[model samples]
Target: MTAPRSAAPERSVVDRTLSILGAFDKDNRTLTLSDISRRSGLPVATVHRIVNKLHGWGALERCADGGYSIGLRLWETAVLAPRSSALAAAAQPHLVALHGQTSLATTLAIRDGGESICLSFVSNDADAVACYGGPGRRLPLHATAVGLVLLAHAGDLVQKEVCSGPLRPYTRHTITSGTLLKRCLAKVGREGHAVVHGALSEGRGGFAVPVRDGRGVVVAAVGVVGAVDVIRPARLAPQVRAVADAVSRCLRADRPRVAEVGA
Candidate 1:
C-alpha cells in the first residue's frame, strides 16, 4: 500500500508543554500524564519529560494517585494578572461580606479577549449553586451580567466585534439578537449597572457593575449570583452598590495624588 502521508510535523516541545498546561481547564482541573499526552497530542515520553520540568518549576503538582493538577505556585502567579487579581484583591472583602449576609454566590470578573474570566468566586456552597463556571474559570461573554457590563462600556471596536459575532442563547431568557444586545448594552451604560435574570443559567440571576480606575474608565467588573426567586434587587441592590462603590474608591485611591502643603 502507498505510504500514508505523514501527519503534520510533530508539535514542538514548547508548544506541547503549553498544550499540557491548557489541558487542565475548568471542567478538567486534574489529569494524568496520559491525559495530557492525549490532549496535547504529544509523545508520552515528551509529555513525561516536560511535565517533570513543569513540576520542578512548581507550575504543576502531582496528585496523590499519580495524576497532576495545577499547582498553588501557578495559581499565585496567575493572581498577579492585573485584569483578574488587582481588581479581585480590592473587591474580595466586599464579596465576602455580601456572601455572609445573603449566602449567595458572588464573583469578580474581567473581560479577556471576548471572554469573561472569573478570578474569585465566593460561595459557602458552590456545589449547591446553580451558577455556571466555578472559580478560576473562563466563560463566554455573550450572556452574563459581568460580560454585558464590560461589553457595554468597552471600546467601540470590542462592542462591535461582540455584537457582530454569532450570539448564543443559554436559556429561554438569553438575549441573542444583535439589536437587542445593543439595546441592553446601551441600557447598562446608562444605568451604570446591569441586572440580568437567567441569562447565563436557568434559575440563576446576576447583577454586575463596572469598577473604574482613576480615569473613570472601567477596568474590571464585579457581581453576585443567586437563584431567581432569591435575587431580590430591593434587598441586594444596596449591598451590591455599596460594595461596588467601595471597590471604585480603591481604584481611585491607587491613583497618584498631588501633594498639598497645609503647614
Candidate 2:
C-alpha cells in the first residue's frame, strides 16, 4: 500500500527526552548511555545527544562512574506538584502526632493508576519495613492497608484492572486471589478503614483510612504500620480515622471556591 505507512512516525524531541528520563526509576537509579538506549528504545547516538542536553540543564547528573541519574533539579521541581506537596503538608502534623501517640510508623499515600505511592512517611526505625514506609516508594494496591483503602475508593476501572489476575504475592498472607481481594475491598468500604496483617511483610501490619477532598472524593490514604501483635486494630482504627478526617477537612478548606454566577 503506502510503503506500510512508515510503520510509526518518528518520536518528537520532547517524547525522546521524556523517554530518557523515564528510563530511570527507584531500582535503576543510575545507567550508562547504552543502558538508557536499551531501556528507552532509542539509538545510542540519539540518547547521547538528549542526555547531554539534560545534563547541561541540570535535569540529569553524571556519576563518578560515568553513569547518568536523575538530578536534584528534577526533585526540586517534583516537590512543587500540588497533589503530593499539599497533601503531605496537610498530613505531616497529624502524622507526627499519630506516630508520637502510637510509637509506630505513619504514612500518607495516594493512588497512581494501579499502585499506591507513599508521599509522606514518619518513622524513627529506618529498617522497619522500609519498602512500605519509605517516602516515594511504590506499593501494590492489594497488599498494604493504605493501598486497600485507596483501592476501595478507586473507580471500578482500576478495580477490574487489578483484579483481572496475575496478582503478585508478597508473603504468605498477601491476598493473591482476585475473588478474596474483591471481598476484602467490599469489607473495607463498609468499615471505612483497613487493617492488614502480615500482607506485605511477615510479622508486620498496617492500618489506614481514606482522606477525602472538598467534593468528598477520596483523594489519599493515611495510616500507621507496626508489628502484627502491636497493631491492635480495635484501638488504632479510630485514631487513624481521626487523622484522616483532619486531613480531609484541611483539603476541603484549602479548595478554591467558584464565585457565584452573578456576583
Candidate 3:
C-alpha cells in the first residue's frame, strides 16, 4: 500500500474533505458518522468536525436515516469536471453513432488508482446484464480493457501499485497473479489496445483503446462491452479508435471533452 502521506497544511483540510467524500464508495454510498470514521480511519471526533464543515458548505447532505452521502452541490460541481460533462458531451454524438451501428454496449472509462471508473455508457441492447454498470462505478484496473490500457500508459509506480495484489476478482477470468497481470499490461502497451474476456462480468467481453490529447497523454479510454462472442477486435476496433480520434480532435481544437479519466 502507498504509505499514507502526512497531510500538508491546508492540504490536510483538503484531504479531510476528500476523506469524507471517499467515505461514500461503491458499496457504501451512504454512511453514518461511525461508518465514516471506520472507513476513513479518522477518529469519530475528527469526522464529526469535518462532516459539520462539509454539511455547512453543502458538500455533503444528511439523510433522513441519519446517514451522510455526497451532496447535490458536489454532484453539480463534478458536472463541471471536463471528463464528466465537457468531454462526455462531445463524445456522446460519436458514441451514439457507434451504438447505432453496433447495436451493442459502449462505455467510456478513466483511470482511478488501480481501477477504471465508468464515466459514460451507451447501449443498444439493454438485455445484457453487464450493461447495468452506472456512471461513477469503479472496477479493478487490471481486470478490464480500459483499466489495462490506462495502466499500460501510466507511470511505472502506478503499474507496480496495480500489479501488487490484493487484486480482487469479479469472475473466473480475472487476472489475479501479479506476474501474469504484468505480462498482460505489457502486451497492452505493445499492442496499443486490449481485449478482456469476462474479467469484469461474465458473458461479456470488453475492448478498449486510449484517447490521447495532441501532446499524446492518454486522456481517457474508449471501450465497449457486448455479448461475449461479438466483442472481436476486428469488429469493435474501428469504432473505438474512431471515437478516440474524434475526442482527440476536440481536445486539439480546444472545444472540450467529457469525463477524461485521469490516473
lDDT (C-alpha, whole model) for all candidates: 0.78, 0.87, 0.80
Task: Look at candidate 1 and tell me the lDDT of residue 235.
Answer: 79
Per-residue lDDT tens digits for candidate 1, residues 1-263, read: 89887688767767888898988876677899889988888789988999999999999999999999999889889766655555777788988998887788888877777778787788866652435566567776768888888788777878788888788888999988888889999999898888888887887888888777666777667788887788776777788878878987886786523111110
Residue 39 lDDT, candidate 1, scale 0-100? 88
* Better model by lDDT: candidate 1 vs candidate 2: 2
Candidate 2 lands at a TM-score of 0.88
Runs off by more than 4 Å, candidate 3:
1-17, 41-46, 82-85, 124-132, 255-263
Clashes per candidate, residues 3 or more apart or on different chains: 0, 0, 9
In candidate 1, which residue pairs get closer than 3 Å at backbone N, Cα or C atoms, i.e. clash? none
Can you write out model 3's per-residue Cα lDDT over 17-53, one digit (the tens) per residue? 7877888875688899999999888889989999999
Instruction: Rank the candidate models, highest lDDT first.
Output: 2, 3, 1
**Between candidates 1 and 2, the TM-score winner:** 2
Candidate 1 residue-wise lDDT at 120: 73
Give the clashing residue pairs of candidate 2, or none: none
lDDT value for candidate 1?
0.78
| Model 2 Cα shift for residue 191 (angstroms) | 0.5
